[model samples]
Target chain A: MNLMLPDSGLLFWMTIIFAVVFFILAKFGFPVITGMVEKRTKRIDDAIGAAREAETRLRSLAQDQERIIAEAQAEHGRILKEAAEEREKMIVAAQEQARAEAGKILEEAREKIQEEKEAALRDIRREVAVLSVAIAEKVVRKELSTAEGQKEMVDRIFDELS
Target chain B: MRKMLVIFIALLTFMAHPVFASGSSEGEVDVAEMIFGHIGDSYGWHITEWNGHHVTIPLPCIVHSSTGWHVFMSSKIEHGHEYEGLFLAEDGRYADKIVEIGPDGSQVRPFDISITKNVASLMFGSALLLIIVLSCARWYRKHDALEKAPGGFAGLMEMMIMMVHDDLIKDSVGPDHRKYAPYLLTAFFFIFLNNLLGIVPFFPGGANLTGNIAVTMVLALFTFFAVNLFANKHYWKEIFWPDGPIFLKCPIPILQVIEILGMFTKPFSLMVRLFANIMAGHAMILGLVSVIFVAARIGPVIGGSMTLITMVFGVFMDCLELLVAFIQAYVFTMLSAVFIGLSRQGGHEEATHDN
Candidate 1:
């Protein structure tokens, strides 16, 4: 038997069958498999991108929180400083008012003392004048009783007049 | 076990008759013929022998000739019988083929289009491949979105298909490989399935489909068409007039002729390489088995020991052939991809240079 020779019948069958198989596989089989693989790859990539975006957003939010806390702390420091300054101003004004009130009280007290000393000196001068008048009246009554003594007193008075 | 031993004794007695009848000058069973017969294609499927009876499944014999179409079962031509001017020729130039007796009693060869042994096996292998591949495709379609990873038969088939696409086609054919992926995948799986089937020494498997030259030729032809059909203008330019100095072209243009011949030789080697490897593997197995029968001619003692030894060696060779089956299929597909890839390199040179 010639083993190498090709049989016409078998060749015809082989060609037809192989062609049918090739077309069927090319049309139906390959596209589905490749499509699934591509889809899976795309899904994984999208998931990774979303995760990275979320991470960045979280980081930014944390930064915003830190900034807000720092601003609040600075505002608190300013309010405390303003309160300290206001307290110092009130204390200084109260001290100045007290000093002015003490000075006015001292002046009033000195003026009253001087008035009291002048009144005391006037009363003493009145008492001395009354005492001298009473003494002179008593002495005149004694000299009239003695005529001779009275005549001598009249002559002395006339000479003083001239 | 008793039945096997009865059959063995029957075969010995049957074979001994010829030696006794022929005066014991030489061995009765022709080893070369036996080997060739086992390797050759036939018009019937040989099942087994039962009580000196040859049990076979006869196929249909269809022929077209100058007269008209002649269709009949192959059994009509059995046992040297002739029917409707057709018979299996046993002598001369057209021996072992169905021929018609002309009006002058001379032999005339008709166009034989019979479904021979190899044809039946091819059909069987094709059916098997279709079942496996189509089922995998359907399963992938149903659970494609839900199932992240392939499972079961679908998983196995996907791994192999991806290997062909990524490792074989993409590596060789490059970026435009998607267009050619289907054809390459089909060719690889088809050849691989047939090779595996040919190793099974039973029904639906024993016929040497890949070992047949016509089958391998057809496979190679597909690759040839794919390579040339999609080839761009630059491919032809490189082949007919390669880029070289003018002085090199002046010396008889030998390079151009060789380049042109290389195109045909590429596919030719693909065809012959697969055919020869598979055919030789089968022949080697058959030759190993023949050692037992040959040893029997000396005596039963030697023959029994030879049978044991041959069985051990035969099993080893069978394992080797299994490996060879996969390797040959891989080699055929790989070379086809490389050749097609080479053809695709035509228009990409400038694009690559720009990059």
Candidate 2:
């Protein structure tokens, strides 16, 4: 009987004790615990979010690197090809100029050789003229020993001259 | 967990058999008095009887009668002695209560607010509960739970509190659980702490706190308010106009009456289940210990053998009561949360959500 029936005095005390426990716990105990847990959860979520953002950024950076490498490769190929073409053009232009210079030098040498031959011929001609004149004078000196012959020769020469 | 308690009891009943034998030299042991006195509340802590003298720690006796307030130590009225016209009632319906010879020549109960055995134990238990929990809470305040996990006693307490709140109370109390969590959590750990303390056979324990109806009643009342007071319209509607056949609701309101009766019955069951479970566990262990004493009347052979057998049974029962302690606490807290959840639902949602 005493076991089942509730006592008013104990009930009163239990109520008071319970109220005290509940009040203290509700005010001091529970909030801080749950708050810490809540704070921990939020912190974890924020970390995950930041990690995901970093991963995306890293991926994009890798992509940018790849793109830049490809562009540089193409630019390098184009510049190398242009240099090859310029080298071919320069070699052709130099060959043509060298051939023109050789032809002009040959023509000047031929003309100078021609001028020296003419000068040599003219000197020979002068020496031949002096020698013929000296031979004619010797023939005349020999004929002059004959005075009478000289007079006849002089009259014929006068007629011929006229 | 109860190793200490069973060992102490073994030392008392087994090693010192003749003490009980000589203690009961007057006659056979009063099994009812022994069992009831162990389970029941008392004005003093009966440690043991040494050299025919009761070694007791007298508690304070505070009583208010029709005369006035009378404050005294329970020691004054020990061993049937009278103090200030008041004494411990030995017989009648008011047995063990502090009563006075009234104007009617019969005994009358005073408005007693004394620090009796159970009350003192409850106080000690609650204070200890605060220390264990508040210390764990101090760890939470000192260190950040967000980055670090709890360890040692703090870790154990955190795990337990989480299990009670998250695994049990959180789901049972539904969406608005946070609003009711404080009271529910408080009730839960209070019962759990006191129930554990009740199993310890020595100081700071050995008193039935949660097993007492008054304590359980107060606990049940906490759930009752958490349910009925904050309940939505659906709760009342379910009680008065539960979804049922036209005949049950319109003609006699039989189903509705049953539904309404269930509201009170639910909390009543919560109260009784906790009280009976713990009370029965204590009774069983005490009964087993008393068995050895009762059978010792036959012979020393029977007594010694029964002592061994009863020790085994007592240890087994104490272990069982230890399990029952946690289970009963969980059951009460879970049920309270469930009742709150049931009441706080929107109207007609039960019809839509079958689960």
Candidate 3:
């Protein structure tokens, strides 16, 4: 066969077929394949977004944990401070209570000592009156018989003393 | 019997003598004889003067005394045209007006063109398209349980589909290609079909459909329209305004104009690259074949060896042409995809007023 260019009939038909085929393929085949690729890409991006969100959540959680820890530390310091203040108050209260009790005891001891002294003085005075009465009775029995003799003796003693 | 034998001897003597040995002859041919031959010349071909141009239109490859070459004009060329041009040279070579040479001398002059044989390429392209499309349609109609992978023809197509899906769309156009996958597949198969048809040895398959500047221009135009129309604000902004210091887009007035021009030229470059590669291959092959004819005429001693060597070289080039056919198709498809990819960037879509 001679090697020559083809006739126009071939070119016309080729163009017709080309246009028709492109139309059909464009409508159907392309969409299916592209859909798959798009799905895969979307899936990947979603995965990345999820991961990013998770990371952010984790960071926030860590921050929250740190905040809680700080609050607990502050609370602990506050409690310790309150406990120290209460201890000082309790010590002061206990000291005041002891002083009041000592003052009451000393007042009672002084009253008891005063009462004992009064009692002893009362006993001594009774003993002294009894000794004076026994001496007078013995002297009366030994000396003067009558009332007159006794009266004269008393007058003589009084005059001698003056 | 004696008369017939003398006539036979005379014929033999005439054949033995080389007519071109000397310009002076018993028959000194005139101007008409040089071009059209004798007025009653059986061959139905002739050259006519058109603005001082010797336009020779051929009617048939096999010219006869009665039926010469036929002429055609641009007005005669149409969408579905069927015509042939033939010219007979004194050297016994039939010159057909096939290639159009451009005014630039360097450029292949653009003119009214037609595919010489449309039926062959059309049939080939249609057959390929029909086979693939119909088979897929049949498979879908049957609604067979979806296989994890493809089988037979479906399997083979599936593999290519997968490659385009994973390698091309997923990689180049990104995952969002689900929306555009159909375009990519159609583009790939369409170009592939034409490429294969082009490489076929004879008939319609070799019209260089994909290589034709007009065809490539159309393809590029589609991409240009598609990309620009669908382009998001980000894609446009990056090209024109850009996302840096205002100075980077410096000499603001000049840069803006340049940026706009770049957008138009990108698609133009795509058109030229594919057309040039395909056309260059044909020119090279033509040059190689010309060598054989030229050498053959210079005496068999040198001619025979040179023709043999050239044919061997020609065969090597033909093999290379096969690789090129696929590469060109791929390049065209890939570039189109890249353009589309650009359009989808940054999520905001812009529509052009043109279809």
TM-score of chain A by itself in each prediction: 0.51, 0.68, 0.68
lDDT of 3 by residue, B4-120 (tens): 454344333322221221122233423223222211121212223334333333222221122333344422422223334322222212223232223553212122233233233
Kindly give the stretch of ten consecutive residues in candidate 3 chain A with the minimal lDDT sum.
A1-10
* Maximum-DockQ candidate: 2
When 1 and 3 are scored with DockQ, the better candidate is 1
The deviation in Å at residue B282 for candidate 1 is: 1.1
- lDDT score of model 2? 0.83
Pick by DockQ: 1 or 2, better one:
2
lDDT of 2 by residue, A100-137 (tens): 88888888888888888788888878877887778777
Model 2: colliding residue pairs: none
Q: How close is candidate 1 to the true structure, as a TM-score?
A: 0.75
Q: Name the 10 consecutive residues with the lowest summed lDDT in model 3 chain B.
A: B35-44
- Candidate 3 lDDT at A12 equals 40
Candidate 1: misplaced stretches above 4 Å?
A45-162, B1-29, B245-251, B299-301, B349-355
**Candidate 3 off by > 4 Å:** A1-19, A32-162, B1-127, B143-145, B244-252, B347-355
Winning candidate number (lDDT): 2
Winner on TM-score (1 vs 2) = 2
* Alpha-carbon local distance difference test for all models: 0.79, 0.83, 0.57
Q: Against the true two-chain complex, what DockQ does each candidate achieve?
A: 0.37, 0.48, 0.11
RMSD of each: 8.0, 4.8, 18.7
Locate the minimum summed-lDDT window of 10 residues in model 2 chain A. Answer: A30-39
In the range A28-56, model 3's lDDT, one tens digit per residue, is 55454344434555777788899999999
Question: What's the distance in Å from true for residue B103, model 3?
Answer: 26
